[model samples]
Target: MATPPDWDRNATWGGSNGGAGGSRTPLRQAFSSLSKSSGKKTAQSLSASGSTTPAHPASRSQSPAPEQGDGKPTVASDAGLADDLDNKAKLSLSRQSSVSNKSGAGSAAGRDAGAATAPKGDGEEDTPLQRALKNPYHRPLPGHPGNLTTSQAEALLELTQLLLKDGALHDPEKEPPSYQETQLLRFLRARSFNVEAARTMYLKSEAWKKEFELDRLCEEFIFEEEEAVAACGWRMYFHKVDKLGRPIFIQDLSNLDTTKLLQTTTPERIIKKFAVTLELAVRHRYEACTLSSGRWVDDNMMVVNVEGLGLSTFWTMKDQLQQLLGVLDQNFPELSGRVQIIGAPFMFSAIWSLLKGWLPAATVEKVDIAGSGYLPLILKYVRKEDWPKHLGGECCCSGATATGSDGATPAKGKSDGCLHSDEGPWDKDLVVGASPRPS
Candidate 1:
């Protein structure tokens, strides 16, 4: 991959002067540029990959799912907003190119791509977790014993309401007030139950999409940096889904040439690359699920190999790392369902700890630190055949084992101090600062 040599040349976020953990936007009014469509197009166009392609219609029709447990599609709103939706993105674009797997590398994170989001019905034992996946925002109060925690429920309510107000939605079919059950909960969780913070985060996301005219960007964008990404040795590729049903992503962060990386690609390109990749993956999986089982699941897991990480390597891209985290947190919200960190060096502990502060408490917690038994930890969620032998799996990629991640020293805790339980909304310990217990 020929690295693009103009990465640092792009303008940084003039939007905020705040560094890592600073006072972000004040919700009711987050960023000043809340509406990127407000004529900065020409000014910013010179800075970004400005598309001359006209903007596509931002709103579209929605296919109502069963109003969760009520067994009916949500009733149309008196406001007629029911006709405008799927920032579930259920609405389609006319493009033919499915974001293909020509990505740089692979991991055992693959799943049935055709995975469905089916709710428990007759003969199917319904549990809180199962219900949450079906529709965590659905009613019956989510607190009727074995239901969602007070924090989780309230967080969803606050964040979803914000999205709805901002015109983002996916709601209950037949229910009257299951209200704005948008898929924005992941962002809320990522902020550790901070409604205002979550709201600001999501608003920035919306603003970004609008600025880039993302609906059309996804329909027309093509990420040709595959070779450059591969050259970085930190392969940012998509693999199959995991058995537990999340798209798998693999990146070996240690081997990349940070100097080359910075010299070759701008932050805008990196952000766009990640965004377009995600759009393709989500659309691909959504289609696969709808076609195969008439359902939808949108989330993924990852394998990050830190084999060669050292203080020097860490310092080299420290700024980039900070930028990447901010961009992803604001833009990619809740997409990475889980992460497995392998090939961790003693230096890994420091970097991990630092990075954790930048990430939402929920995201940090879901991070699983692999020990000497890395393969087993991975195999628990991903099958052996799904991964390549380099990672201690039985899978053969393109007839050869791609040497990837290796090595790990177990962190002191069974839960690894990374994330909360994946069980469901029933967890009270789900909140940050809650005591960590065995998984």
Candidate 2:
């Protein structure tokens, strides 16, 4: 075969160690060379074992026994393999730490997040006057106050002027008038009498000028008229009497016809009247009395008597009375002519039936008058004298001591007689004696 080409020889040994016709090195020589080149004690020890070469110390310590059928080395038993895995894990942990440091995040972020979510306070700040306005119980503002705004101030002044004007025509107490009254007069110069007209008309009349100044008189009239309206309304409420002696009627003026009389009339007229009447009624309540005898006896059942009317105030309140009369004519025509205006009384009678028990018999008798119809008679007798003799004496007639025509004495020794006498003992005696004498 002309000796096979050198290529055939190379192929026989897989192109490295020759096989068949290729050149070859002994396995022991190769192992010896590998052991020498490695220079490891374990490799040298394994090389010395020869037979099949003992495991190296590093390999024996790290590698597990290979599986019977598998050709791959066990990863758990491989020393290099475990070291590679550990090195990769350490590299990954280092990278994570570096990233966290660069970002700069911590616990402070949590606190800020909580503060952004927290509720909000009532808004009740206001001035004393403002608060008063909001409160239901606060009193209404007067005609003027320094703190009021310009518009409010103007309105107040106008209202004050109106009230003063009304007072001039109706209020007697505001006699001689005031600066406010003068301003009101100027305002009403054409409609009502003014100071110049009064001077022209009354300056010549000595009597008129002495008794009254025209301007003052006119003002008095206006003031009185206003006061009367107020007084009427007030009396109706405090005395619990209506325009017709019925129960009080506190109705609104909205429904009532107040437009017919004076163009200047207003709801305030009624309100002011009601207020004044209440004050006066309370003051005069104890002094109020009804007339018992006369042409007009019982005619004015609920009418306050003249004694209780306090006439000294009449001149001051004359304008008020006229205004009241005007109001009465406008609203309650029935009482316009019949109602008798009166003044407050000087004294009041306070009677207590229980107190009678404490009084002496004679004193009770002296207080009691004859033929004067019960209470009226007693009052008259008491008015006439300082104190009755019977009140200090043993006579137990109580206040019924007025003598009868007969000589017979009043009944005694009976509780009913001591308290209330059914038939007047004096009456019986008088009747008995008046009877025809036994002929």
Candidate 3:
């Protein structure tokens, strides 16, 4: 893929004077203009009015899946606000583009043609996650013990009420709420079900999303250096699943060439890629996993291999990694299933001591650092047929391998095996289309 033209430009959050001061971001300005142009009060306005009236419509229609062209989700007329945002966002992106052009950067970040929203198609046999896409505030999947408790359900209702009254959930000109019940639960769980604290966190997250232009980033941002970055040994891809059926994200950072990676893609581009990837996982991968598992699968399991990370390499990549981790902690709370760190070298201890201090206590608790003979622990979560033979599991992407109990084998691929083969429940039995699904 050709490189985008806005990768090197600096991304500013809020306004110049800082914290919603000075000049507003182009999207924020667009939203302000939109609110003025439209005579009706926006959700934001309604919330501030402090009216007891409810904001949501009495009933909502489920939208259809992606139509033929461009693989983007189509919204109804009532959802025109999001469509307008997409147009304005595209126009405002040129300021960043011009900055990159002036700097003469060879590879820059550029958005895809349109800002796509989640598909809202209704299929009678759809999985819980798919149904959730169709209806933003979907109820929990039936018969799952992990389903919300009676009190938690009531709390969810209360939380949504608070968000509606505060107008903190929906930013009409930016993006709509997604899996709203599950999303609210995420914040509630993160804040230990304190409605006020969760509300605060949710509001801050929404503000940050606007400042970061998250909707546009998720819909249109393209990682032009994906192949080159992978070639440089910065590999992180969704592979198979763990015991609980969450997608397994294999991040092999042992061979990362920091200098080459920087040369290939800007740090800004890398951050955008990370955000986009998470958005995709939330929108598509998790949904597919939920379908395949016959239960709701909301998060993912990650395995990080850091054998070759020395002090020098750590210093070189620390800032980027820190930013990525911060993004995970602040924006995507309660979404990680587990993080297993394998192939830890002796020096990894010293590195962990420094790094753990910077991470949230909750996030730190989710991570498990394993030493030699860690394969057994990994296998306990990942099936033998799903993991790569090279990684000490049974499956080999090559067709000749006999791995599964049945005559099943992973779809054939290169000799490197499961690391590159994105074979999982997500791909087993689905027919979305030739084009990739919208985030």
Query: What TM-score would every model get versus the actual structure?
Result: 0.54, 0.16, 0.59
lDDT of model 3, residue 140: 27
User: Which of the predicted structures, 1 or 2, would earn the higher lDDT when compared with the native?
Assistant: 1
Candidate 3 per-residue lDDT, tens place, 1-439, comes to 1112332212222221112444323322222222233223322222222111122231144221223232111221212322332344444345334423443422221111000111111221211222222222221221111333344445566778998888666443333223345567677766656678888888887778778887667656666666677677677676776655578888878667888888998878777777767756654566445434423467778888886777788889889888878776777786775788988888889899989987866567678898757887787667677776656677765333444434343333322545445666443212122112223
| Model 1 lDDT per residue over 281-382, tens place | 543332222222112234566789887778777888778779878878778776665678987877778888788888866577568786446877776666
- Which candidate would rank higher by TM-score, 1 or 2? 1
Best of the candidates, TM-score: 3
User: What's the lDDT for residue 129 in model 2?
Assistant: 18
The runs of at least 3 residues in candidate 1 whose Cα sits more than 4 Å from the true structure, single-residue gaps closed, are 1-162, 168-182, 286-296, 371-373, 398-439
What TM-score does prediction 2 earn?
0.16
Worst 10 residues of 3 by lDDT: 110-119
lDDT of 1 at 161: 65
Model 2 lDDT per residue over 175-250, tens place: 1122222222222221122333323322222233234332232222222343233223221211122111111121
The residue ranges of model 2 lying beyond 4 angstroms of the native Cα positions read 1-235, 238-301, 305-311, 335-439
Ranked by lDDT from best down, the candidates are 3, 1, 2
How does each model score on lDDT?
A: 0.43, 0.24, 0.52
